[model samples]
Target: MKEIVQINLDNEMDLILAHKRCMKIAEMCGMASSLQTRFATAVSEVARCAIAKGKDSLLVLNINIIKATQKEITAIITDNVDLKSCSPDAFIYASKISHHIEYQYSNNQSLTKISLPIPSPGLLSETKIKTLIDYFKFETPLSPYDEIRKKNIELIALSEKLAESENKYKQLANTIPILICVINERNNVLLVNESLENYLDKPLLSFDRKTLMNFIHTEDIDGILEGWNKAKQNRSNFLGETRIKKDSNYIWHLISIVPNKTEDGSFNSWLVYFVDINAQKMMVETLKDNTQLKLIQHELENANSKLRFKNKELEQFAYIASHDLQEPLRKIMIMLSRAGEHLSEDQKKKYYFDRITSAAGRLSNLITDVLNYSRIENKEQYFEKVDLNKIIIDVLGDLSLVIEEKHAVINVNPLPTVFGLDTQLRQLLYNLINNALKFNAKQPSVKVLHENVPKDEHLPIGAENYEVIAISDNGIGMDSKYSNRIFDMFQRLHERDQYGGNGIGLALCRRIIENHNGIINFTSKPDEGTTFWIYFPKNKLYTAKLSLKNQSSN
Candidate 1:
């Protein structure tokens, strides 16, 4: 192989140089003028293809010997273009005029080799090749004016083709409903489609970035700006969902930005597209509203259920109150009437008077218990840190007389400070301890102990971290079947005459515990002792309808 000349095929001027160089080389190799023109035109066609599809295109003229009596002139065009995407026309015309043409691609580049057999191979030798190479090295290139004139002509032809393509693209853009815009690297609006103008109902007068942002909704402006800036900085494609203003209302749009790069891979411009998504967004919002409506309906139903339960409780309390109060009052009246009738029998009258007094006291106690139960509904009380040990001491002091009468032995253990109404908690312990003493047959023995229970215990109430207080007593216990029923108002397992209670104490105790967000349960056997467990959440502070001022008042 022998090399002659190489020309860079960058612009139309370079294209002219590549053609001229090929013709000159062919003439020196003993080719006719007509054949020279044909070969040069073929080389120019392939070189033009290289310029359009790839960058840094080069045209090389060389001579190669095929056999002992054969030599050929070859034109090799190389560029950074993938062969798969390059047009076959790049080689078709060149192949027809040239003896043979070969195409190869590698490393993201294409090489087109076009060869034409020299008519007189014998005239071409090492000496002749040297002459041709020297002729190109010293030959004066095209004058500056001629170069510019040829470039102008090329630009005119290119501009005509670009105008045709732009017209077609504008027709398509205007027919579509999407809003399209082209912006430069500085974010200045370069062009906008007819659809954008029609949507805004006016032509865009300003080409600045701020002017374009005015069309976006105020709430969505920051997000849109941030996304655009990030995509511009990275010179990459971007997609964002935002609300754009239309007339007085805001509509959702999906904005897509595609970047255009120059030959050197630098950002040149950005193509932005806005697609209406208001319909989809509205559908999503409607579904969300329906879900929230369902949740509110469920909450209302639960509140109604609780109200109905409370109403039933009130009805039961009314019936029982009338029966219990009338019984005591009737007995007192009957005893009084008997005492009056047997006025002469001093001993019988004295027995009737005692029976009247006992009945009256029972009635008084029943009224006092009823008042205590009703007081639990008062929500004015506030919560504070209550020491359980102090509560137990106070309850003991109040029940000291009963404890002495029963000769009960009580054991105390250290307890933790909890959050609750002090007065309510004191009443709770008082009722439990009083029951412990009252229900016992033998000498009463009670133990108060405390421990921490973990959330994983899965207690009957639920699994939650709790501070548990166990109050066990060596007292006669009731049937386990009454455990749940005993908490009801006016419910009692034992005979009222034997227990001497109106049956409101345990119910009051349960209510107080509930107000403090705590749980109380007991385990007992008929002959053995009973163990009452009270659990308070370790981390929670219970307060019912606590106002800020009331909370501090405690």
Candidate 2:
């Protein structure tokens, strides 16, 4: 009698196929056909259990078919499983079927089967039982680490995905647009993107440190050196404007080379993004030429020529208007003087001829102010070192009549020797000091002082040397609203007959300060004094006196 071979099936599909093939083979070996069909039924039941509880694992079943005598075969099958969770009725039902089968296997796996096959009556004939027993005696059970093998497979899949992503990141870095370049801290080229290859018309691998500097323009070499030195010393990002030679043409580029630092605050490399700024540079050059520009004498001459033509027209008009009106005003004044001689005391009281005489005199004064204001600028003249103290003294002497009339106090401080036209500075002092004297309230107290400004006491608006001269006065102060208008010509805040003068004084002051390339601003309040501060920039106008000082000392 031959022994039936032992067979181990890993999973449900393997077990079902193996059982089908063995059943067909067992019947040919003279085993009962009905009992072979019973073995197929049992294998199908185990397959359902394997599918329900095993996600990535499988069910293992061992089967043995034995032949004891011709036409007698018995099968013994074992499955590695547990069924503690099955219902009591199901267990009772399976136990009943186990008693009827020639060889019984328990349904202990997680799945529930609808039916268990019963062996045909007298079908097995006890031939397969002996064969199945011999199969179990030679084989051992499989180990449990088979499930851990699946976990290792999943880990390898994740590792492969991570590697793919890293490669993609490097690929994108080498292909992005803009003039991308990576350089080491020593300014050695590390990588260049494909967009830069398109611009250079060369392959990326050909770009290296050996030929990099040769592409830069010679005129920008020094500036580029200074920028690189600053980056290395400061360990900071370098941004500069430079030109490059490409295909025998120069292109301006704004390069932002930022250092990528190591952990210890030292740079290991740099990232550069170059932007073409040639169009913007050319636009700036065009705008500079368009402005009526340059400190050159020719442009100044052109400006002076325009001013001379306008001034000539204005002076002639003022002279003619003043001459024609003065003649009629003289005749009216002479006739009024004679009329006063003829009228009696009562008639003189009825007629006010003095009003007409004063009105004509005011018109004449306004005309004179308009003429002087229009012709204030002498563009043909040059600045010279002039004693401003002498100018102030002359102004004080010119207004001596008013000082005596009000018994007003006046103080003149030592002034600087500034380089300016004497005519302009003289007019500046005359207008400002006269306003300080004329605007006083009942107390007619006026003081003029000058002092040197300290170097650091300035908020520089532009690049220039400035001297701050504060002209303080004790006058009838003005409010904020009227203070700005007081400098405008013919914009008087009070009636002329009351304040007693033409309003061109402050207007003339503003124009004179402007002609000297200076600014005149003031601070005032109601019932408080006013202080006008003049900011005169130091130029040939102010520094020429230094040479005179040394020569005087010698």
Computed on alpha carbons, the lDDT of every model, listed in order, comes to: 0.71, 0.56
- What lDDT score is found at residue 28 in candidate 1? 80
| Stretches of candidate 1 exceeding 4 Å from the true structure | 1-351, 378-381, 453-458, 461-464, 541-554
Candidate 2 residue-wise lDDT, 488-529, digit = tens = 766676666557777777888888777776777777887777
Q: What C-alpha lDDT does candidate 1 achieve relative to the native structure?
A: 0.71
Model 2 compared with the native: what TM-score?
0.40
Worst ten in a row by lDDT for model 2? 542-551
Please give the lDDT score for candidate 2. 0.56
- Estimate the TM-score of every prediction: 0.37, 0.40
Q: Tens-digit lDDT track for model 1 on 1-554?
A: 88888888777777767776777898788875446666776777788777777788888899898875899999988888863267677577666656577888888788888888988888887888899889888765543323323333332333344345446545644765678888886667788888787787556654344665778766677777777888878877889897878888888888998886542335688888887766556555655676667655665566466556645555445344544455445544454554345334553332234554565577667767876776675342476778999999988999899888888899999988987888888888888888888888899999889865443322443423567888989888978777756787777667767777878898998888777777777789997989888877665543322122323555
Give Cα distance to truth, residue 91, candidate 2, Å.
99
Query: How good is model 1 by TM-score?
Result: 0.37
Off by over 4 Å in 2: 1-316, 341-349, 378-380, 453-464, 541-554
**Residue 453 of model 1: what lDDT?**
48
